[model samples]
Target: MRKDLHEANRLSWNAATRAHNSHKGDQAQFFRNGGSTLFPEELALLGEVHGLKALHLQCNAGQDTLSIARLGADITGVDISDVAIDFATQLAADAGIPARFERADVFDYLAHAAESSVDLVFSSYGTLCWLSDLNAWAQGIARVLKPGGRFVFIEFHPYAMVFDQDWTMCYDYFNTAPLAESGVSDYVAESGDGLAVGEYQAGEQDFVNPHASHEFTWGVGQVTTALSQAGLCVARLDEYPYANGWKGFDGMQDSGGRRMVPPTGMPRIPLMYSIVAQR
Candidate 1:
């Protein structure tokens, strides 16, 4: 199981690296237009971090890491993707942003980081599901945090993960079994154009590889329990019924620039959650 998890991490990080390098142009726009800023409503939930040492876990391409740096935090972004770390470092240097990025597995990185070195640990949307063991993940978070430090996360609601690709209800939300692979297009790459595969840059094709996609689902209660077991006090939790970013649902509309199930006009169930916890 440990070996399988490591291999899964390697695959995910490699895929993310290729995706970031190939889709840099679109991704930059995506972030600027609110991809990294997906939970704009929860920005204030992170509270103040000026001059604080912050670590960003699973920080693909460093958008959110740089975003935190812009707010005056001394930031270090760790990802399992060397490609992503290279691009992120270059991007930060080019933008004159003072931030550092490293390619390391989250668990390995946390294990080696000096205890109580970081004042804040931040992660966001779509990050936690990639992790196979919640307890180990939580322990790593606890190991790296300073006394009274905080860990903040914003992620896709597990309830949303239970829905089938057709956007109709399916599957057991509480089931812990690994899900079958969905050979669908990347959520961020798919817009109103309908399932565009392979990235495009300056009217030309960028990287294209089929072995680079994977997905997983995790329950909310399970995640909270892991955090508690790690000795973190849950500070605040908020669920939003709407998402301001791409949601993998057909017939979903980017209503007024925010993504939500539409036309049927149902008050969309909470699709995402943000949590703040203290060590």
Candidate 2:
């Protein structure tokens, strides 16, 4: 069950949820204002979700979940962090969006779901990193999905994740080892404030959080192969040189307020990738 990994990450994310919900950014504002968190690329891949029964895995503060519900899908979101689920539930209610949120490890949640009951399984950026097993994850996606149901996912490319902030190769692309680190930053805002659960690292750090996290690296091929092995047909795969979300790269610039483009003179790299699969 990866209990230790789950516990560590849960604490980290619980801390992150607090900061994220209160941060005064477009993400926090948009969710509070009932705005959609989805970008154009995934939205186009989603096609028509009207009236579909969709399950959003690792759904953080329900911003994206509510966004999908606004598209007319019967949405249910699941996350490992109880704090995240609670905030998501409250956010949905405040947004007047009818949705459900459950705090459970995604694998366990999918295990108990009725077979072939869900029309769609969805997840987005920074999701797969928290997972230790892609094969089991894909199987879960296949388990709850109705026949011909779709799995839409987008994540930071492993190729891009291997590099550090300075674009130096600091990590392995195919490393299966659990990368553990303390004193990480909250992406939602620049300050941890009440969210810090551990001692913040001194000297020029990003968003500060005391909690530690465990992450695993999986390559693009591993993801596709796992989905295919789990009885899902790969329908589409796309890679983008720019990212829809921040990746903590130095000197990256925004592209038309939509994507974060790499700095000038830097060699092109795949910052993100997407996959659409059918059960």
Candidate 3:
């Protein structure tokens, strides 16, 4: 991964971090009231994290990190955004959750991480797209996991990323270039997934971010192959017809609660996928 590319993304995430938090109004209070930002999909995948040393990569603001800590895991939340780590640190303190937050490039953190150290490596939602080198990411994951340790991951299907928000096929699934996007932080309009499943709704905030982002897309096959090459056995690969929390496409229907499914009459396709790789 080029340092300049990652640095640009880091700056962008730093600028957008506050906007993401604006949507989740008063998160410190939310956690203090015993609220969790996790969804059922990830919870089922991360079954029984108690007593495990868990690492959460790309943990923006640490909502899910604190949630996992509440589940009895000794967890560390990591992100590239400095503002995000600061906010997460304060949130953990305010919520009285025992956890650690570190601001570093995922690859850097993984490179320096003790080998065979963590019991679980977890990430979810829009994680893979931020990675510039899949091989390095996979190797890092394998290096940090204990023998028999699991890497539980759920991410937006690459197939779904080929389309624009208006249901137009605007991007190539196999595109290899770093996609450059300016003002990519559309935080105010975020919806479709939350702790109460949008029951405790907060009105959209007027938000703006000036930084740009650089992102990459890796196919499911490529991701699984990387993990295999890194000496991790792929234990499970599951595809879901619906996406949790993110409503990126137009005409998506709420399948009760946070699950967002394609509009009626649309052909079924994988919108999200999960993988369990054991080291």
Relative to the unseen true structure, what is the C-alpha lDDT of residue 1 in candidate 3, on a scale of 0 to 100? 85
Error of 1 at 114 (Å): 1.0
TM-score of 3: 0.94
Q: Check candidate 1 and list the clashing pairs.
A: none
Please give each candidate's TM-score: 0.84, 0.90, 0.94
Residues 72-186 of candidate 3 have per-residue lDDT tens digits of 9999999998999999999899889999999999999999999999999999888888899999999999999999999999998999998988888999999899899885564
Write one digit per residue (lDDT tens) for candidate 1, span 193-266: 22121233322233344443345566888889999999999988889776556556666775554555533656
lDDT of each: 0.71, 0.81, 0.86
Give each model's clash number.
0, 2, 0
Over the stretch 62-149, how does candidate 2's per-residue lDDT look in tens digits?
8789889989999999999989898888777766789999999988898899999999999998899888878899998999999999
Error of 2 at 79 (Å): 0.4
Regions of candidate 1 where Cα sits further than 4 Å from its true position: 1-3, 20-39, 180-185, 192-209, 212-215, 257-263
- Show model 3 residue runs off by greater than 4 Å: 192-206
Whose TM-score is higher: candidate 1's or candidate 3's? 3
